[model samples]
Target: MLAVLQVILLVLDIVWWLVIVSAILSWLFAFNVVNARNPVVDSIGNFLYRATEPLYRPIRRVLPDLGGIDLSPLVVLLLIFFIQQVIVLYLIPAVYRAGV
Candidate 1:
């Protein structure tokens, strides 16, 4: 059961990385660095925005706008990655248990 939990945590970490990549790509498309005209880019960007927006929305409200810039995405990324690190720490217990 401990080993199974470790595997689940690892998968969660992977999913967080996927979210980060999607957020970055979405920003790139929005800024026109990537061709937003492409159908695939459009779909991916919209979907990413939808996925990540809920986290950003509340953060955006409390935080002051930095001259129209939104730092909520950065905040979301940091929080998600930090939680992933905590999840990885659970594996040490699983390893110790396996030794016995």
Candidate 2:
């Protein structure tokens, strides 16, 4: 139904932001801009890792090694954007036509 698709869209949006935040946090950690030793920072990093790792793992497996670069987050964000577009441009319209 439309409601279900909307929920899916909402979840995707949340995930999209999480991925962005995780990526930014990673860069901060890499550049030593954030203190990893601090309990608060460590906890936030761990939470983000746990939240996004499952989504990134599969993509990481398929992607080629790029030395120090990690592209999984970018790939995940693209896939999420693609899914959101499909849901918005096609699926929702179809649902409307079907009177659901």
**Every model's Cα RMSD, please?**
3.3, 0.6
What's each prediction's TM-score?
Answer: 0.65, 0.98
- How many steric overlaps does candidate 1 have? 0
* Model 2 C-alpha lDDT versus the unseen true structure: 0.98
Candidate 1, residues 1-100: lDDT per residue as tens digits?
6566567767766657667877679668667799988898888878777777777899989999798567877787788777767656766565677773
Q: Write the per-residue lDDT of candidate 2 for residues 3-91, one digit (tens) a residue.
A: 99999999999999999999999999999999999999999999999999999999999999999999999999999999999999999
RMSD, model 1, all Cα superposed? 3.3
Model 2: residue 93 alpha-carbon error in angstroms? 0.4
lDDT (CA) per prediction? 0.74, 0.98
Worst 10 residues of 2 by lDDT: 91-100
Q: Largest TM-score belongs to which candidate?
A: 2
